[model samples]
Target: DRSARLPPYGKKRLKTCSFTFRNALLNIKEELQKAISTMTARATHSADVAANTSKNVAEKLDLALAIDKRISKLASQAIDYSSQLSGFDSGLATQMASFQEQMSQIKRELKEGLGRLEHVTANAESAGWYFNDCTC
Candidate 1:
């Protein structure tokens, strides 16, 4: 949103757009095709008023379609490198969570193993005065 805050080379703002970067042009192209078909269907439309109305509608349709196309192109250019931009944050967070779980498991295992070692060490330290002095 803060395009002014961005550097000159990176003047992109991923705003809430009606059409996404990937499919806006295709959608505008489809709309233009439909408008052209509508115009052709009225080919037999005789009368000056009818022809004027059709031309006006066609011009409006073309203008709308051109605006959408331009917007789509600009957005696509801005977003082409956007795949790994903020998109990887989600995947990275998931991996970090997995790593943390693994680390916690290792810590638990170490704690258990250390508890066993301390028990053995305490028994060995006290064994010579109490047991049969057996080294086994």
Candidate 2:
């Protein structure tokens, strides 16, 4: 009777081990899939942020260019008026002075904006490096 029971005991042990192994493998698979999903989502978010940042940079550059054009036109006008006036055109001179002040303000704002953009770009690059380091 003992000999007959031995076979059944060994078979039961084998079944338990196989079941445990299968469960372990399934758990590992699920964990891997979850990790992959999380990474994909993070990558997508990063790409979106990069794209939006690029768009914002383009817009800012356009604005800066427009400001430059306006400043150039105003300077040309001021130069022409100055040459035409011999101690004259006080009103035009005052207007040109105001325009010059406004242009200076715009230049300051553009510089600040470019500085901010550079800071943001640097941060993004650092973040990318961090992500790569973490992944490795």
Candidate 3:
């Protein structure tokens, strides 16, 4: 009587096991999709960062080169200015020496003229005394 009352159990158990397997597969697929999406986003972000960094480094190098060129030009200009100033100093010194020589010559001439004037005065005085003695 018990055996006749017992219901079949194999089909119902198989159905339940198949449903659990399907749910497990679905969950694994969702996790894989999420992982793929995350990896792709990270790759894109990393590429962008690398590109921007390269561009910035290139720009900075260019700026540094420009600054170096400017400094070299300025240094050359300073050297030229120093050379010109040195030439001017030498020329000025030569001119001052010439002026000093001319001044010395002028002083000598003045002294000669003074001596001549004194000699002329002595001659005039002698002539006046001779004229007075003859008139008296």
Best by lDDT: 2
lDDT of 3 by residue, 67-115 (tens): 9999999999999999999999999999999999999999999889888
TM-score of 3: 0.62
RMSD of each: 36.9, 41.9, 5.7
CA shift of 84, model 3, Å: 2.2
lDDT of 1 by residue, 32-61 (tens): 999998886666454566889989999999
Q: Which stretches of candidate 3 lie over 4 Å from their true place?
A: 1-18, 115-136
lDDT of 1: 0.81
Best by TM-score: 3
Q: In candidate 1, how many Å is residue 25 off?
A: 70
Q: Which lDDT value does model 2 have at 1?
A: 52
Poorly placed runs, candidate 2 (over 4 Å): 1-6, 86-136
How does each model score on lDDT?
0.81, 0.92, 0.89
Clash count (model 2, backbone only): 0
61, model 1: CA deviation in Å? 19
Model 2 Cα lDDT, one tens digit per residue, 14-53: 7798899999999999999999999999999999999999
Lowest lDDT block of 10, candidate 1: 10-19
TM-score per prediction, in order, is 0.39, 0.55, 0.62
